[model samples]
Target: MAVSFVQRRFMSNALQKWAYNLSGFNKLGLMRDDCLYENDDVKEALRRLPQTVVDERNYRLIRAVQLSIQKDILPKEQWTKLEEDVMYLQPFLKEVKKEREEREAWNKQY
Candidate 1:
């Protein structure tokens, strides 16, 4: 059972990595998280981020845009690797989502 679980986990991660590479943004040095659309939750997450994180996010975006306009990708070494990519904004977004859910629950007085 443990062996099958390990294989399943490995296969799942392999498929995810393959899909991420096929998505093309990694070529531009953008992580999968960086490609997420800036909806209200994402904007809230950005607002909650530290100045350094915000700066880094902006720099990555600008760099990606510049690369896109130049019809170029980052060097192979600089490409975003699946294992190294972290969803920096996801925690804040999840917090915002939780707050919204709580507010909705409180509002349901009927």
Candidate 2:
């Protein structure tokens, strides 16, 4: 099933909280937000997730797609389609980092 905005927000928040708790970062009121639009906070949280955790999460996502295929929820032709895109996780995180920096800079300019 395609993830809705609310579900995506929940996933992002859950991931961020998990990252923070795993990394021992103690920023107040950080865990309560469900918005992933805050790029800096998301980047920091993503950065804090252990390499193993990232890998495990990636594997789980891939496995979910695989199961979807098995259940005919997705076409088999599309099974390998996202293989290259999966590598974008790191670059995507970096993009979020850059966006965060830009946002902070913009905020400072005001």
- Report the number of the highest-lDDT candidate: 1
TM-score of each: 0.86, 0.30
In the order shown, what is each candidate's alpha-carbon RMSD? 2.4, 15.9
Off by over 4 Å in 1: 1-3
**Model 2: which residue pairs collide?**
none
Query: How many steric overlaps does candidate 2 have?
Result: 0
Highest-scoring model, TM-score: 1
* Candidate 1 C-alpha lDDT tens digits along 25-78: 888877766888889888888899999988987899999999888998999899
Query: Which 10-residue span in candidate 1 carries the lowest summed lDDT?
Result: 27-36
Candidate 1 at residue 32, lDDT? Answer: 63
TM-score of 1: 0.86
lDDT, candidate 2, 1-110, per-residue tens: 89899999989878865665453212211111222354655656667667985676556456555665666333434333212223324555677668788999999999
